[model samples]
Target: MTPPPGWYPDPHAPHLQRWWDGAAWTEHRRTPEAPTVPVPTPPGGGTGRARTVALVAAGAVLVAAIVTGAAVLGSGDDGGAETRTAPTATASIAPESPGPTPEESASEPSADDPSVVEDQLNGVTFPLVDGWVRPQYVAQDDVVMTTDGTYDCPGDGTVCRHGLVVSRTVTANDETSPEALAKADISDAAEDAYDRDAIGQKPYGGMESHELVKQGPVAVAGRAGYYVRWRVHTAKGPGGYVQSLVFPSSVGTESPVLVRFVFDAGADGPPLADMDRITKGIRPVGDAGTGGGVGSSIGPTG
Candidate 1:
């Protein structure tokens, strides 16, 4: 007998989140699953009360996956405890050994592979899946980061993909301090991103949903930071789940941060586990305690 047409468990594949397409498990269950249907516009533009809740629930799942992944990845050296070392301090303490020469890295598969790689930016280290590139825009409130690219859609050719991870900042004067604002912005963006034109009638089926969940109180250097998750049902054309993480400026030491991941949606494994592994290893540049300035930090806008 065949399994149903939704998510199912696969004894043959451990750590894999399998989806039934009314057929056998496709050989490609290594990535997140995009909705195999299209998003339904609420009839008569009815207040998408359920839709909004679903989107929020989805976000919570995504955030949990990321933070969990980070914790697992960072556990290789320490017994699963996050080290209190700042990326800046670590870099200054020991000059990084030069990585593969451009010629060498080029010879190897591109860093933009489904496998997320740890990247260092401005003394910070974060995970970015291979292939997708950051959106080109000014760093301001609302326009946090954008990434557009293509990825394999299992059982189909590659599909066009674009994701925008936006955010809003809270200055010292704001009622919410950097600490509170960080969580609020992330939680709010997760909510707003799913609201009016949030998904822009993207082709995902109505099965998509969002949930708010705790990610972490992981240490960013000496300061503490939290993580939130967002998961949205997306079009299955490209065959992979696409989601973004928006952290308040305080999370990345007062600079808003957005990270996106897109891979074969039909991938057989649980996406959260894979995403968790990829993101947990990331180490941002500075300490959130710094309370960075707007002129230098990136915010939500474009």
Candidate 2:
């Protein structure tokens, strides 16, 4: 008679049970319990304790085979020995949980936050005020530094404009001072605008011509520098200002770096004093304790 569809003592290993599907044995196996009573040995054969040990060893081998997902066949010990075959069943192991995302794993401070950002270039560092955004390409290019600001214009709902640009170049002329450079730069810009007919253009509504209102020697990071201020002539409404700070090369032979601050006065934009505040805040990128300004030793030039 065939066995029922249930667990029965393994025909090949007496210490373990194998699942039978009413026919052949399956790959599933489990140890119910260690035999409490000694397993009997064949007549005139080994002792009962020895038989028990052999049964325990067989149970261990069966466990290993199951863990490795291998099929084990057993032979029945009836009048005729019969072979049992089982289909292979693989062991299931759960997958590991995923790791943290890029945003979650990042520990560096956010660049978007309204805080000072350090710009490292030309062996100098400057503090960029809150709400200013730097472009990725600026990191690779040291000669040019640029930042932008956004605000709601009087007629226009919202607008973004260039807030600051610091352009550096190596000049061989050691005789040139910051004051001279500032004058030349402002003069050149005014001349260029006039030649291009950009002046009196309504790109900025009512912005007609540019006039140099101030030119003076200023020190930045305790170094000699000069600043030139320009007033925007507007046909109507409050006008804007353009200011440039030129710092001569710390070393006599190298060229000076010019930082320009352009503020287009919107109905809601910052004042000229606020623009000056930004200019005075310029310091070597890493210098925290020192203030940036013009040296008293330098005098203002018309």
Candidate 3:
């Protein structure tokens, strides 16, 4: 019974208070303080044991403020590292296209392709004469027809034309004779349009000599084709007229087709008989449109 010193509680930390000193306990602990309650003085007549010690000190301060608000809401989730918790939201959505499928609208390119210089992968279609057309960037290929505009390059600032044309699909060599690929493609189609013009600019002032103004065999689109035609002689104005014209494909791997030509040689060019009326209007791509020339009318002489 050696108990008569100061602070008590803490019989091994019961919410603090230690310091006994009458028998042992010392290491001075603290916390546990609220209990003092002895103030009812000013009222000279308030008995009943001072109103039951002020109602037991207001019910021990409302049970120590509800156990200190339940230990501060249970240590607010280990209160310290800036609480976070927030994730649960999603909604992306997208997928619904559908439309083109007749074999992808027959392999795309229609509004433009069937317009002119139609190669449609060598099915053939280059009709359109009476001032040739098509190729206003319609997927432009191998110069593919021109001469509906552009004039200037009398020297070279670019652009000059009295006629133009080009088509492809010769699969480079293995000569399948269209008269030896139109005599080996009329000297590279007279040096690609009068020697230099596809932006390398030399305009007519280039190509100074060419000849063979005729060769043979012709009847394109109805197959059996060949052509040569030349005349070049540039270095100035009114000097042009090249040609090539192979031909084979009426559809698929009959592959051959070449077709080339220029013009410009005075009289505002375009009429070596519209190069046999555009080689008598090449057809075969479903044929039929006779508006601007149509094949089978036959175009001959070289």
Q: Which candidate is the best by TM-score?
A: 2
Task: State the lDDT of candidate 2 residue by residue for 1-302, as single tens digits.
Answer: 33334444565674665555555764444554443333457678988788879778755654444333233445566656555544233232112111121121121223443244333222234544553444433322322223454434332232334344444543545545788777777745433222222233333444567876777777676677788888665554454666667774332123576666555555443445644555566655346555676444333222
Q: Residue-wise lDDT of candidate 1 within 77-142, one digit each (tens)?
A: 547754321111122212222133212221233344422222221123333443333434322223
| lDDT-better candidate, 1 vs 2 | 2
- Could you tell me every candidate's TM-score relative to the true structure? 0.33, 0.45, 0.25
**Candidate 3 lDDT tens digits, 1-302:** 23334444454445655444344443444455465444555377688888788768765654343222111112356675442211111111001111222122223345544544554445556656668665463233455566677788776766666887777668666777788888977887788678775557777778988877667776676667777788888888878788888867665346677878878877788777777777666677557452323244334332
Better of 1 and 3 by TM-score: 1
Every candidate's lDDT: 0.35, 0.49, 0.60
Give the clash count for each candidate: 51, 6, 1
Shift in Å, residue 171, candidate 2:
3.8
Per lDDT, the best of the predicted structures is: 3
Candidate 2: stretches off by over 4 Å: 1-114, 135-162, 170-175, 188-202, 205-207, 234-239, 250-254, 294-302
Clashes of 2: 6
> CA lDDT of 47 in candidate 3?
85
